[model samples]
Target: MGRSSLLKRIFALNVAAFVLAGLVLAFTPATVSAEIARLEAAVLVLVLAATAAIDFLLLRRALAPLRRLSGLMETVEPLHPGQRLPEEDSSPEEIRRLAVAFNGMLARLEEERRRSVERSLGAQEAERLRVAQELHDGIGQSLTALMLQIDRAARRVPQENPLQGELCGAREAARTLLGEVREVATRLRPEALDDLGLANALEALCARVGDQSGIPVRLSVDPGLPPLSPEAELVVFRIAQEALSNTLRHADASAAELTLAVGDDGTVTLRAADDGRGLGDSVPGAGIQGMHERALLLGGTCQLRTLPAGGTEVALRLRTAEVVA
Candidate 1:
């Protein structure tokens, strides 16, 4: 029975016992009846007090498991998936059943999360590849041919001719367009990341952002860090790209820093910090949310917070083994 219903029934029994004692006393001789009535009233009071104390203890015991379950939930992590609540042999039957169902639900959720991340990452990479290829083969080659033709036509024109100036201008414009095309291609997908490694790719990224934004960027990476799976590498690279982009666009800072460190226990830490205006109760943008989702998909943690002094910091941590492809 529910604890409340049981308590109500016990209270009713107490009331009935008091009523019966009063009725019995009413039929007895006058003096004796008064004395007996007083004794029964005292007994009734003691019984009610005892029952209230018992009810409180019963309720506390029945609810203790839920309290423990809540505490365990607070510590659960997506990174370390599939952990189950403990079902002790001594636990109440209801609590054991609850724990079993909770564990099953967690398992299903983790599985769905895995599938969703894989699908998302696959689609993202495929789209990037397509865009990069089109930029490189279509627009890139067309612009190159145009630049060559413009150069040839400019050469054929007389140096003193008025048309020479316009031809030269046309060639310059084509060259600028070609440069932009190459930049777009690179941003779509960094070939260096696939050919070289994370370090070289990140170094190039830092240099490009600094040169373009006129904001100095410093990069520090651990030399002895173990190599990560390709999927994990991509996730880290993309997150760093987004962080730097946000810094350049919104930070309004003169400098930024990126750090990649590997711990002895195989945990990889990535941090991006900038000296600029702080977040200050503002909501995160889509780019930041995307970075966070990507990290979670790979069983990693991403945190963005304002520094105590000023500016903002983006931090990510994940164990290498947890992100195996």
Candidate 2:
């Protein structure tokens, strides 16, 4: 037979207790006169109080598990999944079924969220690639040609002509514009990642960030690390990029370090640390959340923590199989 509902169980137990009390009173020889003595009134009040205490105890025992479940539900975090209520055999049947149903619902929600994040990040990466390619191939090439034309014109102009200086200046301006365009393109999508592989790309990224931000960014990579798929590499690079960006903008640090290594259990780990003022009470901003989402997309974990001694660290761990696959 299906288990009874919680309300029905509670109501039946309470009614049975009350009925038993009534039967006991009916069978007892003691009788209360219409004008009762003080002793009789006192005894009646004590009986009612005892009955109320018993009822209260029974109600608390029956609803304790539900209260616990409600507290846990309040603490559930969407991004961090896998929390579930205990489904012990000793628990009430109603509570056990409710726990199972709630756990299943959480599992489904997490799966749906994972798929949504996958689609959103996938589209974002595709758009970045497209824009980077256009900048490099279309506008980039046009600027190159323009610079060449300007240089040729400068060469043909007589050295004594005042107009020759203007041509040189124009050529220099075109060159600078071309450099800026390439920089922007690289930022959108690093070509080094596609051509040189993760290790070199990461090293180049650190060097570039250090140069631009005036902070010393040290890098360490394990030479024996296994190869990673392009998507995994992109995720790692993006997380590192964001972490370093945060360090530069908010950390107020003088130096930073980025390390990539493979664990003995074949997990890939990336860590970025800076010796700066730690994140005190500040909440994580969009950049930090993006890092977390990227890691989740790759079936990895990302953590941001403040060091005991000083500064902040962003650590990411990914199963090697997930990255390689």
Candidate 3:
């Protein structure tokens, strides 16, 4: 009940107490006035106790809907979306309105979130493509031309000339730089990702990392795996790329494994695990943060944990609907 109604009820009780006191005084003689006063006070105490009990129950009942709404909100998951509180005719009118409004807000937020993630991913991919092009066409070609000139100049110099050795060193360094430039370009945006598909692209990635780091990287992909949409494929590739990079750079790992599995229901799972020192009480860096964000954009989860056998594992699962038939 409202505050005004509660106040009126308390006023009525006080009036009743006064009427009871007057009646007791009228029925009793003056000699028993003290006893009559004590009786009236006892009745007032009983009335107050009853009122307090009733008020407590009323307040609890009024707030029950809020408690239920809180429980429903706790159950909502961002990855799955579309969760809402029940808004039925039987529910309290105020609570019903609240649920309806909250659900509408949630719907708008989910749509906006999806659009934002798509835009971010699109922009990221565009930037990667641009960088890869610049590295390959700009710096790579210049280095190649410089190396050719150095080779010709070295050939013109006398074999016995002391400067010839320095020329040879410069030529060697240029060739090495050109190879590294090409490698960086490939890593930024692998052409095989578009030409050979996700599985082959991943295999190439693992091989290259292993070769460079002198660490063994084993890759396994389910045969006849269905293709994914370009965006989804890129997300998966980037996660693997970051995970392997972390392992190579910081894991102190001698060997690593990459696994890709596609379920019958079109769920895709990618896992990268290594036999090396685990996270070891270290904080997550940008690589881990980026992987988690990319997975979240696809309505997926990324889990990182220390392996039971002693290492770190990065596991990701995406429930994508774009599986090829």
- Return the TM-score for each candidate structure: 0.79, 0.89, 0.79
User: lDDT winner among the candidates?
Assistant: 2
Q: How far is candidate 3 from the true structure (C-alpha RMSD, Å)?
A: 6.0
Per-residue alpha-carbon lDDT of candidate 2 for residues 16-45, written as tens digits (9 for 90 to 100): 668766765577654567999787677667
lDDT of each: 0.82, 0.87, 0.82
What value of lDDT does candidate 1 attain over all alpha carbons?
0.82
Residue 253 lDDT (model 2)? 97
- List where candidate 2 sits over 4 angstroms from the true fold: 1-12, 32-46
Between candidates 1 and 2, name the one with more favorable lDDT. Answer: 2
Q: Which stretches of candidate 1 lie over 4 Å from their true place?
A: 1-60, 67-84, 323-325
Model 2 poorest 10 in a row by lDDT? 23-32
Q: Which predicted model would earn the best TM-score? A: 2
lDDT digits (tens) for residues 37-122 of candidate 3: 77666665665566566555656665677688878988887765667888765665666777899899989998898788779878
Model 1 agreement with the true structure over 184-220: per-residue lDDT tens digits? 9999998889999888899999999999999999999
Question: Hey, what RMSD does candidate 2 come out at?
Answer: 2.8
lDDT of 3 at 127: 96
Worst 10 residues of 1 by lDDT: 1-10
TM-score of 1: 0.79
